[model samples]
Structures are given as structure tokens and as C-alpha cells.
Target: MAISQEISYRLERLILDGGLAPEQKIPSERQLAARLRVSRSVIREALHELQGRGVIETRHGKGSFVSTMVPGSGDLREQGPLMHLFEGHPRTLYDLLEVREQLEGQAACLAAQRATSLDRHRITKAFRALEETDPLSNARPDHGFHQAIVEASHNPILVHVLNSLKNMMLMTVQASVANLNPRAEMRKKIVLQHRQLYDAIISGRPASAQKLAMAHVRFVSKSMRDLELEGSTLIRVPVEQEAAVSHQNAQD
Candidate 1:
């Protein structure tokens, strides 16, 4: 193979193997040449080839970034209508959680079975960040931890589908965290669940990882439902009290 072709092939493998995450900036030509002991011209040529194939994108003044395999927000407006629906009906958040239960459970199972050393390191880092974050403000970190697990699955299609649903997932996570944060007991249970899930993945227990992940999401779903029900009951109590008072005055 030509030197440029070989270089392009190696770079493509890096992206496909999850070494270069979607939208992550690639090393500059100079950096790549130095790291690979190649001439800058060759590196540039390879980058150009990858760009042609839509595997990498170059920003005018910035640098090259790995292109997302699936269309992102910039290239696709399909998620717009779905976002509107999620916002209009709060119940859709439960639907989103149900989807999460399946995808996340599978992701965890795969991660336990296939996570490389580097993948484990990233997952550990994300888990620590989540643990350190305040429960009330940990939505982003929580989502990041789950995303790391999904990426560790090393299933390109799974990673891409979850990435495409990034907005919806974060929305559900934010709602779940916000509602559960105020309840100290629920917060403690969630923290314990995360720890158990992380341990299962790190220990290479696929079955345990899948079970723990699904249970965690289900617990969140149940908590959200309970909160909603409590809120509705609280709302009804005031109305009922007003009705009873008015009725008594009429009877008097």
C-alpha cells in the first residue's frame, strides 16, 4: 500500500476502534507526523483522503475532528420534532427511561465483556467525577458516566444510536436527578446503584452489569412516578378542601 494509504487506514482504524470519539479533534498534522515518524506532507495527504471519505472534518482555522457516523444536530433536523414531543408530554420522559433501560443494560453487558484497559480507565474517571459531583448538580456527569459505558461496548452502531439520542438522554437524566436529589434516601440508593454497576463492569461480570444497569433505570422510573403521583395528590387535597368549605357555608 502507498504510504499515504497506510496512514489513512491507521487513522480510520483509530476512529472506528473508539480511540478517536466522534467530534473529537484529531491531532494536528505536525503532531501526527511527529508521533508516527512520518513527513508532514504524508500526514496531510492521509488527512485529506480521510476528509474526502467523510471520516474527518477540517475547520477553516481550527483543526480536523472525527466526523460523526450519523448525522448530528447540524446536518439533521429530525430530532427537533421529537424534542418538541418530549417537552409537551412529561410522560414521554418515562418512555425515554424505558428505552434507556434496554440500551444501557446492553451497553453495560458489552462493556463488561469487551472493555479494553483504556476503556476501563475512562469509565473509572467518569465514575469518580460523578461521585464527586453534588447530587443536585450531577446530571451532566451522570450522563457522561453512562456514555463512557456505551462507548466501551465497542459496538459502533450502539454507540452511534446512543450518541444521536444524546439530547433526549440528557433530558431524561436531568429530570430524574432533579426530582430525586431532594430526597436524601433516594439519592443514597442511586449512589449505591452506580457503585454496584461500576464494580460489575470493572469486574467483567456481564450478567451482573446488565442487571444492575437495568435495575438502576427502573428505580429511577419508579421514583419519578411516585413523585408525580404525590404531586397530583397534593394538588387534589387543596381543591377538595376548598370544595368542602364552600359546601359547609351553603348548608349553614
Candidate 2:
């Protein structure tokens, strides 16, 4: 990893692991640079990365401090519903959804074949907890439940891939809740999909489970794309996308 990244990781670890309390100020840039034996410029760069991720904040006149909203290890930052978007910055919503379908489908398949009794129980508990949560509670059981599946797969490589997907999942969930309807019917469908996947794993039917899991992931990705397009065409305009469209229109 680059020196800046290494410095960022170390600092993040310190804050996240409770070495630095929430709203606690960090050492000066010069002090940090001296301790890490890196240039102050490198420290600043690393700090900027952390700031973008909402791990820390800097006041204009005051020094930097740990963000009070530091997302947990399994937080939306790490494992939420839309965490997949940062991977190479997908060219389009369609491309992003397609990549998610492929990765999550594989995770479901591996989970089905390798899940233990404990994993089944944990997943079931997560699903039950989801039924009790609402958009207001801001509980992210879905991300954790999916991550549990990946962990049950007993594949280190798959875990790494899933890790890459975590941030996208989180961001996606937040976006969906912010804009999408997420009505009762949609909730039922999500619950059913999770149940089917879980049942296939518990029954020791890997192939069937894999098929269902992949189908479910594909369904979600497609839904997101449709919603994005719908929002673009029918409802509130997406400023980010609109800017691109405006530029294109101007050129044309």
C-alpha cells in the first residue's frame, strides 16, 4: 500500500479500535508526520481520504477530530447495501448492478454449500430482527445478514470480494431509503428471497440455493437500475446525472 494509505489505515485503526475517542482531537500534522515518519503532505492526503469517508472531520480554525458518526466495522461504510459502487467507479447504473449480481450470486452459492447450524441460526435471527426495524430505526440488519452468509461460505477469497462490496451495499441502502418507496410488497419480496436462500443452505442443496440466491441478487440489482431510471425520467431530477446530461446536451 502507499505511504499515505498506510498512514490513513493506522490512524483509522486507532480511532476505530477505541484508542481515539469520538470527537477527540488528533495530534498535529507535524507530530503525526514525525511519528509516522512521513511527510506532512502525505498525512494531509491520508486525512483527506478519511474525511471523505466520514471517519474524521476537520474544523477550519481548529485541528482535526474523530467523527462522532464513525461507522462501525460492519457499518454502512464497510458493509451497507450499496457499498459496491466504488470499485473502479462503474460507467453506468446498469454496469454497477450487473457486477453486484455476479458477486453476490457467488456469495449466496458458497454460503448455501458451507453454512453451519450456527450460521443458519444467526441468519434467521437477523431476518427476524429486520421485521421489527423500520426506515426510521436505521437498523442495517440486511447488510449484516448478507455478510454472515459470506462468512459462512468458508472461503477467504469470497470474503475479500464481499469486503469490496460492503460500502456499495451501505450507500445503496441509504439511497434507496432516501428515494424509493420500499412498500410492504417490496419488503415481503426481500424477506422471501432471504428465506429461500437460507432454506436451501440449511437443506444442504447447494445448486438450488445458488440458483435462487443469484436470481435474488439479480432481482435487487435490476430493481435499483429501474428505480434510478424512473427517478431520472419521472420524479426529482438527479443533479449529478443532470450535470452530465446538460454537458452532453450542450455538446450536441
The CA-based lDDT of model 1 is what? 0.78
TM-score of 2: 0.52
lDDT tens digits, residue span 76-168, model 2: 334432434444443444455566667667777777777788888887787677556663342356556676777888889878866755433
Q: How far in Å is the alpha carbon of 195 misplaced in model 2?
A: 1.7
- For each candidate in turn, the TM-score is 0.56, 0.52
Least accurate 10 contiguous residues by lDDT in model 2: 243-252
**CA lDDT of every candidate:** 0.78, 0.66
Name the regions of candidate 1 deviating beyond 4 angstroms. Answer: 1-84, 169-174, 232-252
Compared to the true structure, candidate 1 yields what TM-score?
0.56
